[model samples]
Target: MNMLHTQLLQLKPDDIIVEPSVTPLLAGRYRTKRRRQTLHTHKQFDDWVTVSGVQKRRQRSCKVCALLRGDRNKSYHTTFFCEDCSHGEAKCFLYPKARREYNGKRVVLQRPGKVGRRKKTRRELLQDGGAADDEEDD
Candidate 1:
């Protein structure tokens, strides 16, 4: 039930309807899986309402910690929260079914190649002639 709620809160109305398609033969009537969206979540408050999105972390503070123990300095920081829900509340939530969905698009961002480089592989270092570009007429 908790997982269901977290997903609902993360909803954003896209310009195009991706969930369902009516392309006759090509499109599916229903969404097979949730697409990994890159959300730029930022930490609003220190402990109560923190956010994390598109950031890679090997170990995140467990979500269950908040459920077992109240949010009072338990340090079970959540990734994202609905602005409507957090407003005017004493604390964001006590035992929220905290779940994390990482943005897979991060793999492209973390590629070893330098930024602004082309998608294709670099040209061959050695040309047909044996003399490399660096060794030209110096």
Candidate 2:
């Protein structure tokens, strides 16, 4: 068995390690596993949203369930249902499918180009500091 596994087996059920020394190794393993699961779930959800049918349907229907059922009594045509299975619009905001649709139309807003100040050229860098012989050769 690995050192960590052996050490873990040696500990009692109720035993707690007070020292920070050993906790980090165990914590690192836990964090790695947690991160892997999180990435897996993210990729799974992304793939589901990007599917051909899902993408087309999401443009017109509610992204939570893709259902068209509406309540006429409340006169809420576009009111979302926030149930246990699907947390309605709140949860939908986390997925891109829900954000792209608008009243049976796909809202296509042009994304602005890359932002932020431009990188300084070698000449500009030399001006900021004393020009070095090595920099001039480059």
Best by lDDT: 1
Candidate 1: pairs in clash? none
Tens digit per residue, CA lDDT, model 2, 63-135: 4333322232111122233233344444331232333433434546643334346899998998767657657
Over 1-138, each residue of candidate 1 has an lDDT whose tens digit, in order, gives 999999888888763376765665545756476766644233343433224855442333433444334334455544434343445653343224433322212232232333244544344433434465446756
Kindly give the number of clashing pairs for every candidate: 0, 0
C-alpha lDDT values of all predictions: 0.43, 0.42
Candidate achieving the largest TM-score: 1
Q: List TM-scores for all candidates, in order.
A: 0.18, 0.18
- Total residue pair clashes for candidate 2: 0
